[model samples]
Target chain A: MVDVNMTLEMVQASQVGMKAIGAGIAVGLTGIGAGVAEMAIGSAAVGATAENKDVFGLVLLLTVIPETIVIFGLVVGLLLLF
Target chain B: MLKPEQMSRLLIVASKDQMAPVVTELYRHNLFHIEDYVEAGAEGYEGFKIGSPLPGATEASGDLVKIRAIENAFSIRSEDFEVKQRRKQSGLQVLIEHELPAIEQEVEGLTVNRSKLETKLKEYEQKIAELTPFTGIPGDLDLYRGYSRLVVFAGYVEKEVSLSVPHEMFFSKGKGRHFTVVIAAVEQRSVVEGALQEAGYQAVPIPDESGVPQERISFYSSQITLIKKEIEDINQKLDAIKEKHADFLVACEEILKVQVDQTEAPLRFATTNETFVAEGWVPTNRVDAVSDSLTNVTGGKIFITVLPIDLEHDVVPVEYDNPSFAKPTQMLMDVYSRPKYAELDPTLILSIMFPLFFGLILGDVGYGLLLLGMCLVLRKYLKVDDGAQLLTVLRNASFSSILFGLLYSEFLGFELPWKPIMFSRHLKIGGGEAGGQGPAIPELMMLAIWIGILHITLGRILGMINHARQDHGDHRIKAVMANFGWLAVMWGLLIVIWTIAALPLMPDLTSLPKIFINLNAAAIVGAVLLVTGVILIARDSALEIVELPTIISHVLSYARIVAVGLSSVAIAMVVNFIAIGMLISPQLEHITVVGVLFIIMGVVVFLIGHALNMALGILGGGLHSIRLHYVEFFTKFYKGGGKKYSPFGYKRRFTED
Candidate 1:
């Protein structure tokens, strides 16, 4: 009976460990995806800003548009954690 | 507050003789945005051609150019000086005619003297550098030049040379090189040149002076110093002249500029042999005032016509009609695009929403106060045109941040004495404290989502209004219905989520009154609305069906407000723990040399870490807040490509009529 109880406890611990790994993957991969997307946009935004400074605010908004993907991932990660 | 100032098309017709007075009166009013007449394409006015500038235009422009040159010579910018009072135009004109030539001659003489002295100083310095290397040789400076039968080669060499034929050589090491002077007969010049080439010789031009090399260097150095003194004196005289005439010269410039503008006004007009026509835009409210002024100026002989506004063909210029407080927000709108004359102006709404979002993202009392102080200091000192306006926007944002900081009970990520009135953003994941309250993360996220719902709904409503006001026939109705469809779909989804998910901080919709008999009326209603919304959207355009997921994603996008804030708090907490708890507090338990050293290091780390976190907080907070509005809110309804209204008159700073 003690052995069975120990196995059950191990299972619960592994479940929590798995949840942690899942949450990490969710946020980490999405962060990488967002970074990749932002690379092209950031360069283009900078080029546009160099030519006309009035577009600075608009370009800044454009450069960070991909970051919304990371926010979604973060929300999902929080859901899994809590 | 939601629209630009109303503009009316103005047509002013006057005889050629009254043109001067009409132009002067229009400039004094400062209310006209002139549209230059195009001679080529104007219909029903083939006789009308672009008018020539008035008689005195050339002379006024010439004077204006001279004044600008004078200002440039003194490096004088009007912004650098405070005009204590406006100078009278008549006094300025007299100064220009009587005193300007004398002042110009005095200034010109000093400038010429200074430049000549500078050039002389440069020549003396060059002579000194040239003669210093020759000082290594024991010889007079004149001995190296004006030889009758001998040729001399004096320069730096890699190795000393031994001449084959008759030659006198002097060699010394100086200035990081081997200096050599070889004097040989004219007949052996080729042999000496060959020897010098083998020794890796490079020539230095000999100076034509009569003294010993060291004496000559000293003589040039003295001359350089004397010339420098003369230049300094000339500069002082020029500075005095600048101080005495700065206000007068600036006023002269202003009067000359106005004179030139008045003379050139006819260039933008359409004219025939006897009369001229000026077409321009005037603010609708100022029409009567401007007409009366023109009538009075021309002795009631001027012909004025108010043309009907043509929304279909005319590209009306936009001038923001916001209050003084909302003026700075116009800078933000300008960064995106000015609103078209027919479109709704979003500056007032942005002024309110921008600061609120900024405060939401960077809610910390210490950071907020620091930002506020920085804005105040910079706005006082930095005099750039846009910087002061930007600082005002930031100042408003900082105030909002302080308010939110109180709500969050946060001062630089540390908990305040009072319990958080809203909710705690302090995470309880570490430090081994049991029953430590985890951050109200779910509640914060819920709040962000609710904000997203309301903001997006407002945008759709505005979109509906915008389309409804446009004259797109059936397309306008479709656009309005499409906005309604999106709203319906969003609310339906919200209802469905409320019924399906037991989310924190959400109202329990099941407890509300039911319309159906025990069949989940909320679910049925939600499904019906969703389907109806989808069908309506499809009717507008099939392409819009592909964008259906955007509705969900846009709502989820607001989660960043919480996410970005939490990350900032996490960084602050980590910095505090590492600097104070791990480094300083641990070392402070015992007093020793090593302990003191560690404590000092901890203090450095704390300062640097917090400084970095504060910078990141501001940049991230400001960018993200503005991003939300520009990306999510603006894309919904804003289509901003409008011409800016610029009146054809200068705002005088130095001179008055």
Candidate 2:
């Protein structure tokens, strides 16, 4: 009876570990999403700035707009962990 | 000193003959910005024709072209090539007239001869390749040509064709080679060529030579070797010429370019049959010096008159006169827009704000150290031409990050041993008695908003100062009224927002009566200031009232600083949690094999996670900082579209003068 209870307790603890794993997947995927967004915008920003530096302010703002997505991901992930 | 340099409009009238001398004097002074002279015939102000370039201008440009060619040939640069001196004008003239042309002619002759040799050598190689297969055949005494009826194809034939051809017509069967020589009739030529092609045959017509194929091969081979040697010898001579004339070419180009520029300056002025009128802007302090020099040089025949301020006509060029620390920021300003000549130079403020914003967003000591180390490495080793100032800005940002890092007690998202002097919501900062609360999103937001208020206020103040400093004449009151009204409105708006945002953060001080009183006061002040600003602004443009939201948005934009910092720290914290969990898990301690594997996995996670965080930190921190300054801060006071003051002068590289 004691052995069955110990095994049941291990199963419960392993299930609890799934929360951390879920948080990891969420943040990791969103980070990738942000990276992909930046990849497109960053190239365009570089190209625009190369041609006429006046558009730098606009380009910088556009390029970092995707950063907000990552920040949102981070908050959601941190909330899950703590 | 805070404003752009003062400029005075100058109109100089000089004789056509004296234009070159006068231009030389102006360039020597290097304080004049020549305005392009436009024809005013439509408005009925045309007697002065646009000045033509002087006679010497053509010659000087001609010399410059030749010098450039020589420089290209030798691959000479002023920086790399050590010039003996700023070759005197007469020395350059002599070289241009004598030595340069001689060396050019000599090099041209050698190159021409070498090319001829190369072509002959290539022809010989072609003959050798053709004659190589026929070396087995003995005779070559013009035997392969001038035979239309015989259809003599003295070339390689298929081995199968060898049997067929010898039977049909005379042919040579090569020993142990795939192709053989063949001779066939005109009627059989098409059929024979078809068979040859099927057997993968190729044609090699015998050359018109008077020797056996072997002897001819040897002769061509020897000639090719001799030609190659001669070409090598010519190359050595060319190398000698390059070494001798490279520095001289660079120096000559600089001196001649200056001459060409001076001689061409007349084209910007307006000239008639006898006299020319040169109109341009010169800084006020240097105007007297320019006037004195032109007078001294032209024997006082020229009259330099300082025209009164022409508001309706003149577009004053802007020259920023900032100290060295702020000079790099000037590049950033110029990259965006040059401030109007009448406005304040924002270089000093940008130099401070840009790095601080960068640091605030990237508040971690480890990353700062990495950045500093990378910068030191780059500066120490790389010889970059354009990115030097970028490195300096990065270094300044790195330093600020380090300072903030210490205050926040963060070193790669790990809390430092010492207590944090400044609180950061994203950091534990310290433990037990030494620590306070970690990051709270609301408080961070409030702090960001407050910083935004301070930064934008400074911009408004500077802008107001700029307006007040302008020679508004009778419009000064209106300028002050509008500018001050806007300033008051911004301050009032900040107070109203702060009172609400900081209420929860200041929970201890929150009371019903105090909240009501503060809210009432802030609302009244904000409403009054907004009404006053709208009234003053309505005098200029009622459209500006539509931009009320822009002010609020600019302040809200500062939240990105805290948001980006929080993300950087949170990602790092997550990385550490996973990594440390792997190493010190209670479940895995007894299982040594699993523990070892976990440690490996943990280290990889740590590296990859931190690397990702680092990249994002740089991109977000650097760009958001720049965006804040350019959009939020610069819009407060700065309006770009100033003409860059470029005086007609040379920052000489190879020459002293």
Candidate 3:
């Protein structure tokens, strides 16, 4: 019974470790995806802002639109961890 | 308050004699948004042409030009100066007719004199530099010139040269070289050139001068000083004139600007040889007052008519008519686009929701108070119209943040004396396992999701109303149904999740009566609603069925509220830990010199760390909150390419008619 309990504990610990790794990958890869999506948008927003200052708020909104991808990833990661 | 002010299309036809009175009456009302008459020759108006300026326009324009020049010289901007009392129109007319020309003449003379003196000073300075290299050599400048038979090379040489031909050489030390003057026979040009090349000689042009180099430099220096003094005197005179006449000149400019505008008003009108026609938009409520005043001024001889609006063709200018409290949010609306005349204005919604989202993300009392103080100071000192409005928006956000801070029981990432009335944002997974105190990660995430669901649903409702109200004809019903379909999908998904996940604050589906063998009432209802929503959406546009997953992503996107807040709390906690725990607290056990030094270091780290975190919180909180509104909420209903209403009259600042 002692050996069986040890084996059960080992399996549980490895499962926790694997879940942690999965959570990290979910958040990390999505963060990269968001950054790549924002790269083109951020530059275009800045360029438009330079020509006309009145578009500042609109450009800012456009610049952060892709960041929602990362937010979704965060929700997924939290779901996995907890 | 939700809709823009209604506009009426106004048309006025008047004989040539009544044109002046019509223009004056329109300016007095200051409510006319004129549409410039284009030369398209549409329908029966082939003979109509754009009118030339009135009789006095040329003189008024010329006077305006002179006043602007003087204002430029004094560096005076109308907005920069405050008038204690408005100047009377009669007094300004006297200043413009008699005193303006004299002032203009005096200012022009002084500027011209100053520029000439400046040019002379530059010439003298250049001459002084040319004479500087010659000063090292001790001969009179006359010796280097006026020698027909002698060839003089007056410049620097690398080394001493023993000329093969008979020659006379004078050498003196200069900057990094020997300043040498060699007078050799002109007939021995080849031999002298070869000898000078061997010595690495560089040639300098002899000046056409007949005096000592030292005396000439002194002469040019004194002349430069004289010219500089004369220039200074001219500038002082100009400054004195500016100080005395600044008020009069600014008032004159304002009067002339109004005159020019009035005189040039006809340029935008369409006219024939005997009569003129002007068309524009005015607020519906003010149409009666404008018509009565114009008729009263023109003795009822002019023809005034309200043209019928064509929804398909007529271009109406949009003007926002909001309450005083919501006026500042118009700037934010303008940053995106103004609402069309027929569409609902979202400024009121933005005014409330924007601050709430900002507060949710940055719920810290200390940061809130700091931002509040900054906004107040800026609003007080900044006189710019747009800047003041922006500061008011920020001030509102700051107040919201303070309210949320009270709820969260947070002061700069630290817990307050009392327990948080709401869930603590600093908690992560297994937070309840440690102390069973505040809410854990799942609860906070669920709260953000709920907010998203409600917010998105509100957006869909607004979208339905917008589609119905707009002139969509037969397709209006379908458009509204599409919006309803989106709403149904969102709520259906939420209901399904509530039954499956058993999350907090969600209804217990098990407690309700079961409708089927294995399913409860809520589950069967949710599945039916989901299927119905899908069918409704497909009925509108078959392709839009592919965008169904987008609703889920949109709802999940609100999870950023918790994620961002937690990241900020984490940073503040790390900063405090590193500054106090690692640096200061360990050394506090002993009051040695090293301990005192470490304490000071820790204090520096603490201040810098909090400052950085505060800036990041403001930027992140403000941008993300506005993004939720503009990107997610507005995309549902807002279709904004409205023409901005610009009236024809000026708000007189310096002179009043």
Best by lDDT: 1
Least accurate 10 contiguous residues by lDDT in model 3 chain B: B427-436
lDDT of 3 at B394: 85
lDDT of 1 by residue, A12-51 (tens): 8888888999989999999999999999999999999999
Model 1: per-residue lDDT, tens digit, B541-654?
879999888898888898888888888878877777777777888888877899999899889987888788889988988877777888889878888888999888889998
Instruction: Compute the DockQ of candidate 1.
Output: 0.50
Error of 1 at A50 (Å): 3.9
TM-scores for the candidates? 0.89, 0.72, 0.87
Per residue, candidate 2 scores C-alpha lDDT tens digits across B507-596 of 221222353445555556666776777788666457777767667667766877887888788787777766665353543657687777
* Model 2 spans > 4 angstroms off: A1-82, B40-45, B79-87, B111-236, B363-386, B409-417, B424-446, B460-510, B514-553, B563-621
Candidate no. 1 TM-score: 0.89
lDDT of 3 by residue, B1-657 (tens): 888989999999999789998998898788999889888986667999888887889998899999899889879888778786788999789878999999999999999888888888888887777788788778899888776788888777888888878998888875667878888888987898888888888987777677999999999898988888898899899899988998888888888888789889998999999999999999999999999999999999899999999866877899998888788989889988888888889999999998998898888898899999999988878888988998898899999999998888878767777777888765432233212254467878889888888888888999999989984766888889888988887787777766666787666565666668767778787888888888888888989999898798788888888888777766776667668777888899988998999999999988899899989988989877877888778878887778999888888888776
Candidate 2 reaches a DockQ of 0.18
Cα shift from native, residue B261, model 3 (Å): 1.2
Off by over 4 Å in 1: A1-33, A52-61, B146-150, B159-168, B174-177, B184-199, B428-436, B507-541, B544-546, B578-609
